[model samples]
Target: MAKQQVISPLPGTFYRKSAPDQPSYKEEGDQVAVGETIGLVEVMKSFHEIKSDFAGTVTKFLIDNEDAVMAGQALVEIDG
Candidate 1:
């Protein structure tokens, strides 16, 4: 298996859950499909879903929830 990285497409604050009380979209060891939403990035009062580019098991999250991120920043790692 090879490790694939999920990157942030825009600069924003990354959120693991849709809302404070909601469960995270994904977590470490979770199965992730291609085009699946792993998280959300909020910018300029708008939120965008961050999708996975590869199908695999989520190996780890590179940053914490609600953390500020930059475009092209690695958000998650997957093994496929």
Candidate 2:
């Protein structure tokens, strides 16, 4: 199996769930499909959905929920 990384598209705050009380978009060990939303990035009050570019099992999240992230920062690692 090879590992792939999901990168942040823009500098902002990374959110694992759509809302505070909702479940996370993807958890470790979860199977993710291409174009699946794994998280969101909030910038200047605008939210952007972060989607996967490849299908694989979610292996790990590099940053915690609501953590600050930069553009092109590695967020999640997926195993294929």
Candidate 3:
């Protein structure tokens, strides 16, 4: 298996769940498909969906929920 990374497109606050009370969109060992939404980024009150470009199993999350992230930062690792 090869490892891949899901990157953030813009600088913002990363969120694993759609809302505070909801479960995370994805977790470690979860299967992910191409174009699957794994998280969200909030910037200036606007939210943007962060999608995976690779089809694989989610191996790890590099950033924690509600953490600040930068553009081009790796958010999650995928094993394919």
Winner by lDDT = 3
lDDT of 1 by residue, 3-79 (tens): 99999989999999999999999989999999999999999989999999999999999989999999999999999
> Please, what is the TM-score per model?
0.98, 0.98, 0.98
Candidate 1: residue pairs that collide? none
Let me know the TM-score candidate 3 reaches against the reference structure: 0.98
Local accuracy of candidate 2 as per-residue lDDT tens digits, 30-62: 999999999999999999999998898999999
Output the TM-score of candidate 1. 0.98
Native RMSD of candidate 3 (Å): 0.5
Show where candidate 2 strays beyond 4 Å: none
Worst 10 residues of 3 by lDDT: 1-10
